[model samples]
Target: MPETNTARLVHRLATLRERLQPEMDRREFLRTLVTGGYALGMAQLLGVEDFLAADDGEVPIVTARVRENPDDPFSLVEQTRDVPAEWYAAVQNAFELNERLARIAYTGYLGSAVVPGDYASGTASISIGVSNEGQSAREMIRDVSEGISINTETIIEIEEIEDGFEYAEPRYVESVDDGRVPSGIACETPSSLATLSPALYHPDEEEAFFVTAEHAFKDEPDPVGHPLALPLDRVERLELGTVVYAHPGEDFVAVEPNGEMRPVSRIAAPSPVRVRGQYTRLGLADLVARGEELEKVGALTGHTTGRIQGVDAVTCFTDEFCRRGQIRWGGEMDLTDGDSGSVSYHSDPDGRDDDVLVAGFNNARTWWPGQSYVWGVSAYKLTAEHGYHF
Candidate 1:
């Protein structure tokens, strides 16, 4: 029997190697080996019997109980408001204009980021807008420096230059210590033209921010509990804790409250497809079915039905020991590096619109063969625990 088991194990290993060969690189192979060893060790200690028992196929059946509504035969009335033709036409025109402007702005912004700058001798090729046409390259660099100072002091460090222009090569900066000016800065500029833009001078200014959807805390000294905040605008910041369960190979980084810095293994991608209004309609069917079932059984006596209005990814961190898996949203949207701690909201009852409910925070992306998964923290759970209405 032992000989037979050994033969089976060898066959399995050979099959795994054969299957993995097509896409496996050195790093991937090493990662697989490590993960496989860990799994085997865990199985041996925990006993595979319980693990196998946990896989029993059991489908839950939901039963509905009837309930009588006190307010029977509630009148269903259509609320109507008349709009003047001129007002309607004006609104339509405004919408069209706004849409055109938005499209132009988005295209120009992304185009500028991807475009390469012209490299000239004796001067670095900097991005010049209509506003900065007359400014000298040196002056432009100064302005960029000032802007960085205003937002984050001395985050950009100028290190030694290599074969390429400053805009084309990575530039390193000294570590930010007490916001004081150190001897020098160090960083490598990407080949992209957007790197030269004053807008992208700050580390957080670039759209490509990393994100992580692991369990994190607001106030904690441990690396796993360290707070990571993303500046939304000039005045607002979205904060989250660190996730320890993230893939160690990812090289995640976070900023601390005391302005200290640490490296993490998992970081979330910043950009996410913002789902709002009609876009959230995709989940409406499933939500409505569940809601209706609850309503029929009087489970929704005080609850009102609301459609999902918006969805965005937020950052979370795992425990210090990295026992739990980090949670995140995985959707069709392209997420960037700096979007780790964004807040997603549903509808507010006291707000202008009452037809929508903010669902949950989108957390991470899970890539599959042909599709991706969007993971999110359920709003229902948050509301239940925090006594907040959504």
Candidate 2:
């Protein structure tokens, strides 16, 4: 019986090698033999050990979760996470394929996102948004896909979100009973009402500035000179500052404080939620694998909690220019017209009452027929682009 079992194992190994032979490099094929018995990704997929590691192959996957500096957006201090290597490889593969698809975005390619699998499940997939025109581009798409599972959404056309409601002009708030104005409160732009966010730290200037979504000022040709303020009512408004800089691509704006009012590290929750710090790209991936949910406060929605659907997503569906490194979570309904500029957060597992780490900024929700979820730029992307942190 033992001899028979050994023979069966040999047969399975031969079969796996034969199937992977055409695709794998000779060096990789040889290195895979170090696993001895399990097929590629099988051991790690089963939560036994890392299949990718040749030596002993029981390596633990660790990633950073919490940061040391809660106030500094650029702070790199983080909590370590032990993840399943198979899950990590799968999610990493999804991110690579998502990038490749974006690089050669043909006329019909609408957009794509990276969907990560739960821990121990060892699965990852990419969802692509495409138009009917892109079907003819299949061969090239397939070449780029490299056998990765790609789900495509065919749309004839796409449109920007439009609601004709106009906001009351110059509405003001004299004061909040609380001294610090948390995020998810009504803030004033020249033409519309938008949500307020926590302080945005710019490393170059070493300054903490008030922040919100850039699209809130989309109606204005240039938002640079626009005033940002707090609205108590139509008659009593508090001024925050003017738009120092606007990043239309990322969908966020930095406001310089002009009055005594300032941006704080607090979020508007029934319980006090203080900003701990932001997550790195891997940190967000770890959050998804652990089946964790994120919470956010919006001007209209108040407070809501939702799962992280995908990470490192590329959204081409929103504007003419594609937005990369987006986080998709919750249903589109979780966000409303006045919800833009709110920050999505996750509670610190370390149990700090006020400490909640931010996931991303909520800019726009779903508009495509099939897609659902609020999408926005991650804090990591903001740091990568402009040396700014939330």
Candidate 3:
């Protein structure tokens, strides 16, 4: 009779799993159960602590320890962190589960982001954004009891973006003003208008270029020939120069100067905002821990500040593939059409008041109903993916 009850309990668990994950097949679901609750994914299974010391229970993960490249994406630093064994195992299980489901891409799987919490708390949640067709909210709640932590977070619905930046009156960049060609001003190409970034140094090329969002272009990106111009007073346009390089995926276009104007390491604020350096993933996490906000100056939006929402966010909603090392911050209203190339920056803690460090580039964002935060690629990601720095 006791054996019958035990068997029944297992059957009930299997049935509950089916109810929760309607998208996963029975065989696949059973494999996931075996993978998560048993060997290959279990860290502290009952009576298994004999295998290793209590202090050794933490898992040394490479991915969690972001790449160690301060300059380029090619150099990988082999540093590891000691994460709680159980938490690491759970994260691994979640990754496997997400991977299996993503392979199927069920009817309404919008996207997913892994939100890592305090390591001591052994808590981490995967926020998945999906449409109504896949699984209902009630079923998902039940799955939580089984240690399947995937939150169906819905953000951004309307894709409407207002027109590009247009000045009520005419304005132009003056060559006479030193540090005038700084960030936060409008930079126009043949196709679109984008916010100008501070002088980005290409160590390998040994040159600096005026950078902006590549998507600001109407059609395809012109890497070498396209010129970037700034609107000004006497002359209709101040030519920055032809595009030296264009990274559509990273969403930055590096323009070489053709005229007398030179790019400076300053932001277009009433007071000087100097570019000191950039933040690592750890640095961004520290900001998140302290509940700090970053400020940005967009060509259209002008200036606005908002709290950082998530760090080391992997966004798969944009293109065919996924974009890792992204920072989600600010309100959606803080950014607009021409604001794509602007940067989010925090004041340097050790440097002077005017010195600031780059956080990330303001590109795409959430425009849905329930959610209201801006999202962008992080500077660390650019250094990890490509060797460019501001």
* Best-matching candidate per TM-score: 2
Q: What would the per-residue lDDT of candidate 2 be over residues 303-364, giving only the tens digit for each residue?
A: 88899888888888767889998999998877877778989888776638778878899998
Residue 82, candidate 3: alpha-carbon lDDT = 40
- Model 3, range 154-213, lDDT digits (tens) per residue? 544434543333453322344435534888888887877778887777668867688888
- The positional error of residue 266 in candidate 3, measured at the CA in angstroms, is 1.0
TM-score of 3: 0.67
Deviation (Å) of 311 in candidate 2: 1.4
Clashing pairs in model 3, backbone N/Cα/C closer than 3 A: 156-367, 156-368, 157-368, 172-232
* Model 2 TM: 0.79
TM-scores for all candidates? 0.23, 0.79, 0.67
lDDT of 1: 0.25
> Relative to the true structure, how large is the alpha-carbon lDDT of every model?
0.25, 0.74, 0.66
Better of 1 and 3 by TM-score: 3
| Model number with the top lDDT | 2
Clash counts for the predictions, in order: 56, 12, 4
